[model samples]
Target: MAVAGVSANRLELLTIADAVAREKNIDKEIVVEAIEEAIQKGAKSRYGAHHDIRAKIDIKSGEMALTRHVTVVADDWQPEDELEEFNDSAMVRLTDASKRDPEAFVGKEYIENLPPFEFGRVQTQMARQVVTGKVRDAERANQYEEFKDRVGEIVNGTVKRVEYGNTVVDLGRGEGIMRRNDSIPREVFNIGDRIRTYIYDVRAEAKGPQVMLSRSHPGFMAKLFAQEVPEVYDGVIEIRAAARDAGSRAKMAVLSNDSSIDPVGACVGMRGSRVQAVVAELQGEKIDIIQWNADEPTFIVNALAPAEVSKVVLDEEADRVEVVVPDEQLSLAIGRRGQNVRLASQLTGWQIDIITESQDSERRQREFSERTALFQEALDVDEVIAQLLVTEGFATVEDLAFVEPYEISDIEGFDEDTAEELQARARDFLDRQAAILDAKRVELGVQDEVMAVPGVTGAIAVALGEGGIKTVEDLADLATDEIRGGYEVKNGERTKVPGVLEAFNLAQEEAEMLILQARVAAGWIDASELPQPPEPEYEEELAEGEYDADAVFAAAPEGDEGEVVDDEVPAGDPDQPENA
Candidate 1:
């Protein structure tokens, strides 16, 4: 059949394939393959269905060829069930093929040429759809390959449109979307406006590749500073940590490798130009550039800058710190609605409790008196001896009971005889306390199963029984946090029971051990079992994406856990005005 413009035009085909490949950012070979497949399908439609059809395009000359392929098979070989139907068209017996070509042998393939035919309207439409679909699939694959590795990078794009609260950005070669929550607070962009955003995530979905962009991410601010500060970019200044409240406020802790250079000053730039540039980009978000310190107390003080801290008492077991300032600076340290202290906590990765100096002093004296009384009553000692024990850092009877005789004797004004006698009394008092607790546990009817759990002392068993957690099963069902710190509810004027850990003065690890033992005793877990958490799958290869200059600065070295310094600042004089 004769058809116009249906036969392969080598030059035009090659030119079209090249244009499409460049436009779609796909390999030219892929486009050529799609065209060849489309042509083969059209040829099959024109020729007899039984013909074995194949097609190829010459890369250099743009020549297209359609051929029928028949494989030579052994005469004794039987055709499979599915192959039996097309055996005559797809394959030829070696004996039969030898008649046509004397050199024909098994495994040899014979090719027959077919004249080019014109395409009908329907065939033309089918070919168009096939090429279009193949090109689209290739384009999507290319897009996924291009952007998958670009996650966590900052990219520039123009706003294409806004749907609901989400903004779509045209990234030249692709498109990205910034969800409403990922955008900085109160910041808006108009159509065609160019903007930079951090690529927090990229995923390949059935519809297309989804590039998630963010403007309020902590990494975004860190990257911005890297762009503005040469020292940060060059690795002389390192950003230890960053926390952002979006368009309101942010804090960054930085350290300098070179002693002569100040990290904060380097980030701030001459006359604050460098930081101002970053602030402008973030819509005037106030940023605090802190001098990072290895000493945690010093770091916290720097993080809560603009407000002076008179003292910081860290509770290492609880991972909490208490900061005391003058009464006048209380509001400043706490910030408006606690924003200052909250940012400080985030920056330092610790829980912070701010108090006035007077409040701290009162709490301190109360704790001292309680310790003194505890030592006096437990050791049958006078107030002077108890005071001495308390001042020597022995805050509880347990300390004296568990300590070596030499340790007690080392205390000022303590003779060996006196220390030995005190230790004996402390041990006797603990024994009496334990017996009383055991009696209480029995009275409360705590199960033997609960008592058998490791770390579940008689006192803890009694406390658990009073709280209505009687059986091993009940204890096993509690969450780690619930077991470590008991929940509390206050209604109008009534206060419910606090957590078991707080009630028994149990450490977090001790509570966890108790729960683990409970689980084992309840037959919920194996006796020798260890927790097997699923490991995170991370891509080890470096992504073919833009470099994140700030990422290097923000990457913290392992084993650099900041230490708490024992240094203390003098208490602020309430009568004197604070330093501005």
Candidate 2:
């Protein structure tokens, strides 16, 4: 107690801690931990006698508190080692009650509070080292939690240092690393540059929080849009699809709930104020804001902006698109080494094949020539023979393209020599017709209008000339069931299930195609307008015991027996109920 008041030793320790906390702008709790560690180390060194001494500091008033070592014991003081005698180093004293009863224990208590001991040169150095380590660890852990939630959120940070292809940014709260891959290719970060980046990933480590930032992620584009466009923020404009090549260029499709507001106009703002803001943040990366379309072809056309599209042919079943552009625009549509088409494909989720108008026309010409050559060969024989061949079904140029000489000979009135002659002539005709077809095909050039009947290839035309159901629009107008009936007698007589018509045997896929073609010809019809065949009335067979009413009436006894009467109402007679 004599050493407790105004002790020079304790006053100096308190003063040092209080001043350090204020000067460093650190918490008072940190200074208390420092002081307690210092005093404990000093006590252990000077009084090498006490093993369990604790100390505390009052940071506000610069006051010190101290306690001595003590250990608890059981009431029964029987010694585990009976052979050892008691010594000062580890001693126990019995109470008066223990002496009388022979079962009492020596109760442990703090006998005295030691004075604050002054540390020697070596002891003082060790204490400072321990305190510094603890304070730094606490600071790092606190910083880690604060920054972890900020992941995926955009933040402004200064470029502090760059090393090993990683950019270190000072986020004010902590430091973040932007790996080289996450940095946009077009962006060049430099020291002291104030930049905006998205926190993509965060992790805790033994040292501190590891924050990963990114500028190239697709989400970064969405976030940038959210910040730039108020319509997007309020949920009025929804981003339907977005794609980016990061620093170079990107395309985004947006849709609006209110049809009166154009999605593209809403995002662009007046004089492109909003989108320009986003572009500036992205270091002038070009962005195309397109109106989202539900129709795949329309959407694809929009995606390839700046390159005007002449046509878009969507093969939905094949999940592909054939985009046609003018000769001048072909290179633009495909972009530099197909980059534009590739990005458009990624954006629309469709495989894209780009073709120039002239190239497409040329390709069609070649196909048409090949088809026409095949048709002319079939037509080179006697008129009767050619007419019979057409009747048996070789109508189209494609039909006869692959026909063998033997198959032609098998037709009525054609001998092997004639078959050979026609086959050779057909090949020659194909050579000549190919050129004509090419000219026709080129003249057509990706037309929306369906062609007229392919030169007498219809049921009536074929009965009068050759192939039936060659075109879908023709098939739509024909009576399918009646055609099916007539076709079965001709070709499907051998099978258990008679084929009604040649078209009836078309594969499921071909049937669907025919339906699509029909739809295009007259536009799809409503179910109500299409005639529905009536259900057949089932005839009920008479049972064995059932007889005619006339027989029963004739067999009935005179007038008393109930008679089935036939009442015929003559022209002017009053009408009577049938049941009566």
lDDT of each: 0.81, 0.64
Global lDDT of model 1: 0.81
Error of model 2, residue 46, in angstroms? 5.3
- Name the candidate that leads on TM-score: 1
Clashing pairs in 2: 152-199, 373-430, 375-397, 377-426, 462-466, 484-500, 484-501
By summed lDDT, the worst window of 10 consecutive residues in model 2 runs over 571-580
lDDT (Cα, tens digit) per residue for candidate 1, span 313-377: 77776788888788998998888888889988999998999889899789879999999988877
Total backbone clashes of candidate 2, pairs 3 or more residues apart or in separate chains: 7
Q: In order, how many clashes per candidate?
A: 2, 7
The TM-scores, one per candidate, come to: 0.75, 0.48
Where does candidate 1 stray beyond 4 Å? 1-8, 36-55, 64-130, 148-153, 380-384, 442-453, 463-482, 485-580
Cα miss at 106, model 2 (Å)? 13
RMSD of 1: 9.6
